[model samples]
Target: MSIFRNLSSRAKEDELMDDFSMGGAELSEALVHLRRLNKIFAAPGPTRYGVEKLWRMMGSPASLSVLDVGAGSGDVNRKLLEWADSRGVELHIILVDLTEEACQEAAALFKDEPRIQVQRADVRDLPDASADIVTGSQFVHHFDGDELVDIVSHMLRASRYGVVINDIHRHQVSYTAVWLTTRLISRNRYIRHDGPLSVAKGFTARDWKELKRRLNHETMTFSWKPLFRYAVVIPHPLKPGGKESGIGYA
Candidate 1:
């Protein structure tokens, strides 16, 4: 529970914990509005900044690949496409999620684009592998404690480049901002419920530290970007010769 305090935003989901926030037409509507909501209410800085940083540090994305775990509706994937296009980098995106309907919707959005692939699966059950970069947005907070550690390990193992988890920071200020923003801009029921719930389940830098300590590797770093009432977390890749990569490995 102490770790739970680190992610105060998740506390609000108490009223709506049963909602999968995925499935059926409601899920589709949430997916649509969420993309709009993120653009208007939860955008990640000036777009190419984070990806740019990774490229500068890692060399190039000319051959980079990315995996979006729990890619609800391709909003993040859409952003990735934009980033790749802007940077002249070739990106191969694998979108995985628990709900087939959501993944199917995402696939429809990018089916014609050979660079993207979608799968209906739990991230935890997925295989360990490597990609130039691995990323996820608005989805990490759904995991806490050991579940969070396991997911991070999966990301680390699956990425040859790095892992970037962009989500909300769990704090009173972030929670308030999100709640009000959802009330003001979005009109979906699942959005209204899952929006605040996401905040409550979010992780703080301190919580991340505890989770990292549990891992077999000792060379991971965690970077935080708390902006526009949201949080951008970067978990760097583990060094092949070193114990493991630091945070923001994506």
Candidate 2:
């Protein structure tokens, strides 16, 4: 089968960054380049859109806590903090990743920022209703099948308000763009190999639809965003008393 054909199905190949033990200078360099690429593509746009939508639905709380799963380098959360600051809202963000190196990098990046915390753990292990909002950026594409469903289910359970997933939209155009852009901007082997592979591992609207079907979440919505991205937003249901069904904030 030709690589360009069958773009409807998600590619199952593992990315170079899939290895949680990866670290050192090369990993560090690749992360820097990935952060730069995210900025160029406005990768945080979809995430912010989902988050703001949920926030507004929650009546624009003065303070919010966000838990970001598979938060590589935590660059996206940094952008979220900036957005919250601009809007005069306080945001306490928790950055979770399976890799120690990623946690270290995130720690260093937010060393002076008291509002951010980096934790090395799986999202599934987190306590229920630990955060007001749960988000994943360029993260969910790493898994498929039952694992993907379980992870997303846990994210929904872990949040009191909603879940926001911002990830690449698998398409030939996105794949080509990432393939060429990585080659032009990064000499790191990992970036060059995984950039396009990430696009290949991306999802489509049908994929999200299937995932929602599996989870049986009727309110979940998946929408296309700029630069070939998908924002999957799921707002938690409210109780009859006009409060969220989850535990109240302290």
Candidate 3:
């Protein structure tokens, strides 16, 4: 288990452990713990920053449609909706995930929010240009290098404007920090295991560069954010008429 604290672990292969499949009451509890950790760490900050950056670079639209891959419990989408409302921005979100349980959880979470829709489908199967902006939060680390590139391409193809992938940055400090923090605050076994393992499985700067190179798109920009996260924003390659950028590929 201590090996999870080492950044070198990512060199072997992507971690195959997935807590979302645990299902039933245990999965719900784990998801709840995960959401709280996401909030405490400000996981939604990068996605919001990406959208704001888009508005700064491209003109703002009156309304925006967002496709969020691996939406989990849709906690991030809920936060984004509140943020959009405060700014008087009309935002609609389609939360796509492969798990029926996750889709059901998200659907229930956003049932009162008319602007959000929950779908159970693989992101790659979604039609092209399905939304104005495509986004995923803490989701990309689940895939291997090639799979990630392919997923990004699909995301870009489905977007009218851009894509933003917010994930962790693999580093010793982050691995240790997340491990200690989760151990102290969370009793959920899944969180205790997945937290540090996620940091180990996260991407490095070189990994992000390779992913960008594979996409062969010049518009993509990568940055490191606070709380040991990575922000990969790819603005629309073409001129925009519109706007906006989930959880697991697992």
Candidate 4:
């Protein structure tokens, strides 16, 4: 199939970062480039949007604990910390990734920061209700079919409040833009190959709708964001006599 066509379905090809055993200089370089690209594309926007929306919906809690799955380099949460500081919210973030290298990278990045912790583990193994919020940034597209559903179910179960997913939006324009941008700016082989591939692996509106249907959750809300991304927020059900909260979209 031509790379330029057949974007109607999510791509099944595995990214180099999918291998947890990958480590050392090459992986380190790739992580660095990934951080830069994420910043350049404002990739952290969706996660912040989801979290803030949920926080407000929950009546602007004074503190929040977030579990960030597949948290590479912990760059996104680093930005989250800044946002929390500005808003006077006490934020504790746990960054989890399957790769030892990623955990090490995050550890080094957040070493002096007591607000963040880095762990190398499978997200599925996490205990239920471990955090107030669970977030997956550019993470969920790595799996498909039953695995995808299972992973998301675990995320929802692991969070006391909700789960936020920030992922790519599969489109011809996004794929082409990423393909060219990575080639121009990144020398790391992983970044060059996986950047465009991530777009192809991204979700469409119908894809999110189907996943939501399969999960049978009524509180889930998803919306498109600038720069070709989707922010999916699933708030936990309110207790008896609890008032519903509003979600503001971008």
* Runs in model 3 lying further than 4 Å from the true structure: 9-22, 238-250
Estimated TM-score per prediction?
Answer: 0.78, 0.92, 0.87, 0.92
Per-residue alpha-carbon lDDT of model 3 for 15-125, expressed as tens digits?
333544456766667777888888878888787777666655545667778889987887877667877888788888899987766777787777888898888888889
Query: Could you tell me the lDDT of residue 30 within candidate 4?
Result: 90
TM-score-wise, the better of 2 and 3 is 2
Candidate 4's C-alpha lDDT? 0.88
In order of lDDT, best first, we have: 4, 2, 3, 1
TM-score of 3: 0.87
lDDT of 4 by residue, 18-123 (tens): 8767768899889989988888788998999999988887678899999999898879887788889999999999999988778888999889999998888888
Tens digits of lDDT, candidate 1, 130-236: 46566767766776667677787787667665566666666766667777777777777877777766777776776667765776444445555645333333445
lDDT of each prediction vs. the true structure? 0.65, 0.87, 0.77, 0.88
C-alpha RMSD by candidate, in order:
4.8, 3.2, 5.4, 2.9
Local accuracy of candidate 2 as per-residue lDDT tens digits, 176-243? 88888898899998898888888888998889999999988877889999999999998886667887
Q: Report the poorest 10 consecutive residues by lDDT, candidate 1.
A: 1-10
lDDT of 1 at 40: 66
Ranking by TM-score: 4, 2, 3, 1
